[model samples]
Target chain A: MSFFIAHTVHDALTALSDGARPVAGGSDLVVGARHGKAPLPPHLVAIDRIAELREVHHTDSGVIIGALVTHHDIEMHALLTTSYAGLADGSALVGSPSTRNVGTLGGNVMNASPAMDTGSPLLVLGAEVELQSLRGTRRLGIAELWTGPGRTCAEPDELCVAVHLPAPAPNSNSAYLRLEYRRAMEIAVVGAAAAVTLAADGSISAVRVALTAVAPTIIEVVGLVGGTVADVAAAAAAAASEQATPISDQRASDRYRRHTVGVMAGRAVQAAARRAGGEMIPVPLNRAVGIGAAS
Target chain B: MAIGWWPSFSVPSGAYVKIDGDGSGQIITGAQECGTGAVMTLRQLAADEVGLRADDFELVYQDTSVAPYDMGATGSQTLFNNGRAVVAAAAQVAEQLRALAAQHLEANAADIVLADGVASVAGTPSASVTIAELAAQAAGGELLIGHGSGAPPAPPTTVGSTCVGDVGMAAWVAPQFSCHAVRVKLDRDTGVTRVLQVSAAHDSGTIINRVGAEGQVQGAVLMGIGQALTEGTTYDDQARQRNPALLEYKLQTCADAPTVDISFIEIATPDAGPRGAKGLAEAPNVATPAAISNALAQLVGHPVRRLPMTAERVWLSMQPAEPEVAG
Candidate 1:
């Protein structure tokens, strides 16, 4: 019932300290309220207008995307589209145009939907979320943020401020792929993201693989980070299939999710290896891979 | 058509038309226009029969007490059945108007030809009176009203209980046929599929409203694509709908719509109600899913025997090994 538009990071934290729920974009929160998915809090702090939270600037360490940075912003950002292409691919596949324009990355990371398009890519990119409160601030790896579907570990008084992604090394690039029945505005039935570093000989020097909609959380697959492209692809696919603990639901059966997750993981690795070799695979791998029209 | 007595039925449609002091008329039918253009079609039929421009007649509907009984707008019955009622009622009204005009012109009612809201002697074009003049004279106590009811003709007694021999029974008032073809692109790696384009051909007897009928097919094909790929209800373990909201139920967006090409073959069937026009409301939706599925089967060289044929399902169908092998 009460509202405040925070103009700065300090003002947002001040409102949060008063138990006002910080709302950036409110795409998820408003939808949840409309559908009665969750009770609307009595007090709301509008953090979308906070100048600092809308920043998308490179730091000495890496790229910093403010919490208010929208999915559309990430999809069209010059630097992220080039360096963190996997995340950009994931961003491009998020919801639809209106959703991408209004749905912020902070809401996606904090809402913690299991089928989120950006989760697996962020995991592969080694992204971290910065949570601020009146008490102080803390950073947690993307993988450590989720407790379950629509649940996150951050305290109610803590507000997500930004996402930090360490820059990719030379000769490294990444890709994300998701299985959708339609071309636009879909939750991934199953998805995979791979960040690959290619050696001069065109073999995968290192890689990190993550699977979405396969488990309670976005899961990282190991042991395929260092191998030839073919070898890494096969291992990542096998590992993802073995590790996936999906449950049967209407979107997909557990068996189908497990199998397709493996396929996507392998394809993600293949695409990432190609990108690492200096091929410019576009974001939203579906459009480039025959599922949608090319730009 | 074979002669077998199937249960033949008629849909009761009621309509009332009022010719005002002005040259215009008003048609009141109980049919609801749920975006199928029933009101527009009714207006066109009534206007043509009453010898007025389509824009001169306005239509009002859905006031049950004020308007006559109509068998609602479902089953594509609005145009075929209610359309008959309006035309018949307006035809009667036109007859009366011609009779009045004939009296004034010193001609027979049969010799008076009605066109452009004017009643004139067929041979003597100058001997004519505008509908507005006659309507004004008939106002007050002599209100000009037209009423009509329409239904399908009864079946012949020879129609047996069962369709016998090689003959197909034609029990309904109108029969329709349609075909749909779709082109799709399948991503083998991610199991994602997008409908690139769709073409639909329809034989809905006669075409009454060309634009309305074509728009019907276009909308139906898009909805069919949703049913074939993304639209479904999910239930929780407790027998509750899990994804009751539109956000989760996954209806197709504008971006998901494919290029649509529509064609109509107007073959006049005698029993197609009033205007040789058949009911085509649900016809376009009937064959789309099967067409899309067949296209996918041809694309992947595998049977797509599932509703929605999601990328996960298509991908799993393509895999030779089972998930237990990985487990």
Candidate 2:
């Protein structure tokens, strides 16, 4: 018989019920088991049947994207592309186009990987996640999403139910970049994403920069580039350089990654400035092949 | 077992180049066709000597029962070592045809020119006969077959290292050199490696088949990349490779590699054979990991010398910096 856990979610404290896991698409879980990265879970509670937990609804307050929202959904949803460009871009960059259709935002937040592509951009965009368990439900800011490598602030028995992102202003824009080894499909060596807003006079009013694959957790520079546009790149680079600590490995050195972060941050800031108020810069790869694009 | 021939010589079936009437040739050898185009190159050399095209041969190889004794398929010796054998056999056959044609045409064997499978007088056009026709007359009463054999000089006992293992071994010495360069991506957080681009420059001696030689270089590079970044066998506290399932044991994915640009330089080697060219197969693979390691050293500003640059190692490297306590 298949090792499985069956339950109906009727206001269930999702996290406590899951006891460290919530199963929707089990890509990550199954991969971890097949690789012996994590022990095989004999019991898995499938939360996908819960309609309320998988719905996307927009209201005047803000957009509440269900945790089950796939990267494919984020890339295609009109409201997400317009209001939450950073989150959409982050989701779209998770893996391949096929992975975008099956991998979920909740899984990413719960996975708690320091090199998580989506985590860094979502954090920089001021996103929040809701963790539900048997006791009740609580919302935590994306900044507090992770504690360390593969470890999050969510209690062992909590399930991340939804991702909350602030609606973008008319002058707000964002850009995401992953520095992978190859142009096709591969994991990031290091990546960086930026979100910015310009004042009425077109000077830098606010900026946010985040780096991935560079630390034990997604490193974000909260207050960045509140000055002249000419110096914003330098200021943002300095902030990221101060906060990031990379390690040398076979592929690259800590010094190279740090150097790359500065280069990437400058590039993203320039890109974000040009992209203000645009629908979204079509997740670089899958602009034409949307919703079920062949990878 | 004596053939009653002079000097106790028997019919030397020393690796005959069998040219079936259909013109398809068989190159019997013991080495696998994995990367070494020895079989094809050998066939081509035999075909050239036998007055035929290189592709008109099928190589039956990697079986000890049939192939002539080879000095193993390493050190780029496939061509100069074994190819000479087939060349000698084909040359002897060509000579036999010249002698036969000379007798039939009432001419000196030395004056007979063999071209397009026909023997004729120099500067004479009409007075020519095909070898097949000449062979037909011989086949009615007799047929001729020739033989050839050669092997590279074995290493002297003074060179090879002493064998500590059960199997007998030979000492090694460097006779060739190659250079390579690689660009890679290192994960900033987890130290994962990804190959971006590879460039190689080698002097293997003679370009027998351009595609075949490049394929060998590319295959060697692929194996080198895997050894450098992926395909590591992990051992536990008891010193065992804990991973048995192929899934956990990582292999280099096609997507994980960058396009490789290879260049082959032919250095005329005086003693290698007909034209100077030493084997470049194993040499190209040797310099790969070293080049990549040097590049990583430059990237990280430190020398991290190990088999694989795993993410765990990189993560551990990113530790709290202990200040110099007034040293």
Candidate 3:
């Protein structure tokens, strides 16, 4: 049977220091019950009741997103809209309202699926994560924390506390596009996010293309292509689908998933560049269109 | 029930009438309605016999344990076959009452006529007495009670044994077709098809209740549409179903069902059925799946065979160009 325990803790950090797993909302954890992949820790800790970790505050350095803050909260946050537009969009498409209302940001990152939506946009925003244990607290880069799907670099007793995203530069924005089948409730088969900044000389300055579900981890294609409206979309698609290893399963064949990643990557690049409107673009997911096509 | 002619009117009391001790009269069974109009037809038969108004009398159809045994109602046969028995019984009871009136009035039997539940004595309006009055005088003698049955001819000269011959329905299955029209929409990217409209035309052969016939037709259409778009227990190459959980095994939700309109053209088929009614339940849903698939083909650019044209299957059929949108 799947074991469940819920209680407020006197010392939140110490409760999890003895190999206890902390749960805010069991979205991905419960889904693993069917496959029998879930490991039931002898001791369970409920951290949502702790008032100290439930606040979202902004600082001169960056924005501090409370680990308990849900996808719904982040989607409507004004600070992230103009600065981290793609992250907000990605959060909106996580799942239906029911899943979003209960699923927390810390749980999503800790679960660490290759197909995770929030991962790519967070990566594009240059985000860092905080993990706490009885010993103390240590900050780790998002890239360093994720080892692979369902396998994180954090120790068994460690719990992710907060995620910090650095504010974007002037005249810069990002966008995310998810391709799926249905309307209200659906998982992204492939997702791509890009941020483009334009220069004063009327040419591309910076670009970043982040892709999910194409590989074992969320990928950021930095120099896949140049940041011009002409090349942004196509370039991202090619780069995202490249250097990816996916196998065929019941959902779809491996070939279709790769092709989808390429298309979405290109579309994401175009979207990010459009938002930049002539500033330094961090990353641009360029679309191929007719750039390399035979006339 | 279809009322057929009663040929065996050999008993002098073959015509019909039901007389009550009181002015009120009860219609004996001249026909069996089953679920149709048997009650109304029998009431009409009795009201005319006793000169009472049609709406004035109430009916009671007791089982064989209390009421007289009947040949049983089936085929459109109740009114024609068993009607003769009840009609003859009522007429016999009337005849017996008239005979007693003639004896009591000291008049010839021919001169005694029944009018308004009474014999017209001396052909004068004020001189009449009720049938109950005459029956009361003849109470010590035989009480008037008539009982008989009706039957079609047995095997005689020109006939052959066939399919319906065993159950007497051989000439019945003349073959028929129910027509349906459907409209649907298809999403090009995902291959998801939506049902917009469904209309059906059927012939339930002389429908007694319009509401009942239409309900059956609509129910069948909904079942067919669900089967065409989604349903069936599938197994993989290793005989394992990938969707063993209830969430994965998709069924039609209430939101998915479309509106249905059913129309009927009742052909007078007295020969086809006992009361000109034929089997309609099975025929309605028979060809619906094929019709839906044809509609989907128009929405999409190809024919969809096999059931449950799911999103994945539809996506496979309409593959993306270059596998990417922008690039």
Please report how far candidate 3 places residue A122 from its true position, in Å. 2.0
Residue B232, model 2, lDDT: 68
lDDT of 2 by residue, B1-327 (tens): 000000101111235565554335566655456657876677777766655567766677545766666566655666655666666766776677678788888788777777666678677747787766766665554454556775443433443455532122221211345678788655544344556688888766677778887887787777777666555676656876655665445556554556889887677643454345456566666777777777766666664556655543433444446221110
Which regions of candidate 3 fall more than 4 Å away from where they truly are? A1-10, A198-205, A273-295, B1-236, B250-296, B318-327
The backbone clash count of each candidate, in order, is: 4, 12, 29
The 10-residue segment with the lowest total lDDT in model 1 chain B: B1-10
Report model 3's interface C-alpha RMSD after superposition on the true interface residues: 9.3
Q: Is the docking of candidate 1 incorrect, acceptable, medium or high quality?
A: acceptable
* Candidate 3 positional error at A150, Å: 0.8
TM match of model 3 to true structure: 0.57
Summarize candidate 2's per-residue lDDT along A182-201 as a digit string, tens digits: 33344566777888888877
Give the better candidate number (1 or 3) by TM-score: 1
In model 2, how large is the Cα lDDT of residue A127? 80
Q: What's the lDDT for candidate 3?
A: 0.61
Predicted structure with the largest lDDT when compared to the true one: 1
| lDDT, each prediction | 0.81, 0.64, 0.61
